[model samples]
Target: MPEVELLLRSRRVVTPEGVRAASVAVAGGRIAALLPHSAQAPPGAAVADFGDDALLPGLVDTHVHVNDPGRTEWEGFHTATRAAAAGGVTTLVDMPLNSLPPTTTVPNLHVKQAVAGPKAHVDVGFWGGALPTNRADLRPLHEAGVFGFKAFLSPSGVEEFPPLGPRELEAAAREIAGFGGLLIVHAEDPGRLDAAPAAEGPRYAGFLASRPRTAENEAIDALIALARRLEVRIHILHLSSADALPAIAAAKADGVPVTAETCPHFLTLTAEEVPDGATEFKCCPPIREAANQDALWAGLAAGTVDCVVSDHSPCTTDLKVPDFGRAWGGISSLQLGLPVLWTEARRRGHTLHDVARWTATAPAALASLGCKGAIAPGRDADFAVLAPDETFTVDAAALHHRNPVTAYAGRTLHGVVRSSWLRGRKIADRGTPLAGPVGRLLERA
Candidate 1:
């Protein structure tokens, strides 16, 4: 038998060097070599040839909320990872909130891994929560291989994972910096939110008014300043306000170790587009106006925004009540991130290469997942076979997410994911259904 276990050839293979016709040779679940597209496959090796479809590195979504172990009703590893594979994401880093006992300690991390090990359909990593009382757990969790620490500048919705105040925020930063760990923050100023009038009723305008651009801007400014003074790395999560792009750019230029990510909901959906009773469009740092969305697109084109991820936070239907203030604030879009981004990105004259870079390359770099986000030698043989020209209308009920509700309920999107592979094994296919859970837990070194 040949040493190469599997060989995949594609006419439009997206590589770091750029898209070209190439054949990938796989051995021991890692990419062994890249040959010409028409190269002959060795004897006794499984071969698959995609004549016109584009081969892309599986996406790495760093911001995902798999509310499992405690709140499995909201979402669990089995459902979430299956949705991930169907959406062409081969690796994910779950957020540390809304789960039972949250990932605030080393023991909690183990509990999550134990539950996720058997159910996940894709490789998974975790982020440790940074609450006021969990300061002592930071170093231990990092040593335990958590990717980083997650904090909020304001009250997190769940009472279990409270937000970090100014003093506590600085203290956490110092502790994490002492160990050279990354601190990812949900930056929304509490004072600004408290000062804004209560956003009651089902009016989308009222909800949008409550979480104004000033709230996100002020919080990001504080984070940038804090990272500069403490000489620590900080990451801004789910950045919706384009008003803060200039400040972030200037700080990055000034050598402050700060990075930012914007979600697909903010980029595609807008405040004007959402109906009053559409609670699914309601998310923290609410989607802004079209002009602001334009600025965000410019930020992506100019490198001000580091990556685009689906902040795939979901809850049961009962949580999505009619009242905007009373309903839960999250968008369920894990299964549609790629096509959603592509539909809009291609409209803006962007190519699949740009999409691959933002969704795959940049995110893997952010989480420091070395083996993921590329189709080159020495990397995992994970790939997303995409028909860039093909299109489909999203059906929420047919999705793999536990809850059938989604923000992309009837949108027609481009770029169909024909198949997704993890470590040379086909885990999900648009045509063939998943056979079993073939995922493993990942850790940061």
Candidate 2:
């Protein structure tokens, strides 16, 4: 038998089969076996018993914006991954846009890796950009091993990363398809946004009106048609409008190669409750009403929405202007995604298995990270010991992210993450100092 380096026994170990009493054995940084709960540890092997706390596969958040390099002040690899560990996320794929020289070229990706390689505290991968000007760079970026490419149909908030026009979008899709790479898009129609009334105040209603659901629905329709015609793999990022769910369902049913993800904010908070001047809740394709949120939940249940991610975009507090129109739009929820989603999901009759599927398994599958998102043997021994019945009140100042701005402040949440393991090593534990910057910079296989 292989020498087990560590044994984690739990009364509630979440596996692909289901949650059950088991002892997970780790050897050489990967899971070695799933033995009975009372299984004895191998000689000299370290053991940690979690009792009834759910031992879940560490989460895989594929929609994070780490924004290192030039935007490190907003969020960097060190703080972002540390925050991810605190939230029970073991792997996160960084989005390309917000960083300086966004990963559109091989050299830019190298620069990003150099900075992140030394600072990350959890496994990190990257997505390359599909900007209007970088069509030729797509194949090179893919060959260099970015997980996929990110494009914006509407204007990206950054001036350098411009949106792809219709022609540019199709050209890029074709180029990516030729290489069999995935294309992830921020889909909000530019024309629809331009036609909407200008938002100029602190009122949440005005901001909601400025970015209507039609913007998302129309953009998704265009992307679906293009995906069907080109036969390229496509993923919709941070889907906020439930009206587009039906079209997404139909696209998938028709064999269009498409998938979609929604964020924790959309599932947990409603526009009706956002107070005026609460710019922290200001994200593009803004959070909608309760009915829309309910539909989003239904979409997840029906599998029209493949996963939930934090979309953990953050900017300096100074950038968060009191006026909703002027503020930079994003929600900083990297450290709160699991608890926030679990608190809401459990209330809706969902189980921990359901939460694991949305936050880990599906997102891992979306990014094609096979070794992640599960507790089975031959997979990375990354796990989160979560006390599902434990509760906590959010306090922004206490979070590990560089910036303490978050929309979840003051809210009570369930499922406190007691500790998180990365590759069989403890990287984070509640009330303990972070272990070290030992995370690997991953490449697509």
- Structural similarity to truth (TM-score) of each candidate: 0.99, 0.99
**Candidate 1 ranges with C-alpha deviation above 4 Å:** 431-433
lDDT of 1 by residue, 1-445 (tens): 2289899999999999899999999988899999998888888789999889999999999999999889999999999999999999999999999999799999999999999999989999999999999999999999999999999988899999999999999999999999999999999999999999787899999999999899999999999999999998999999999999999999999999999999999899989999988998889989889999999999989999999999999999899987889999999999899999999999999988889889999999999999999888988998999998999998889888889889899999998999999999998988343778888899995
Candidate 1: what lDDT?
0.92
lDDT of candidate 2 over 258-351, digit per residue (tens) = 9999999999999999999999999998999999999999999999999999999999999998999899999999989999999999999998
Backbone clash total, candidate 2: 0
Q: In candidate 2, residue 166 scores what lDDT? A: 94
Model 1: lowest-lDDT 10 consecutive positions: 431-440
Scanning candidate 2 in windows of ten residues, the lowest lDDT window is: 430-439
Q: RMSDs, each prediction?
A: 1.2, 0.8
Write down the lDDT of every candidate, Cα atoms only.
0.92, 0.93
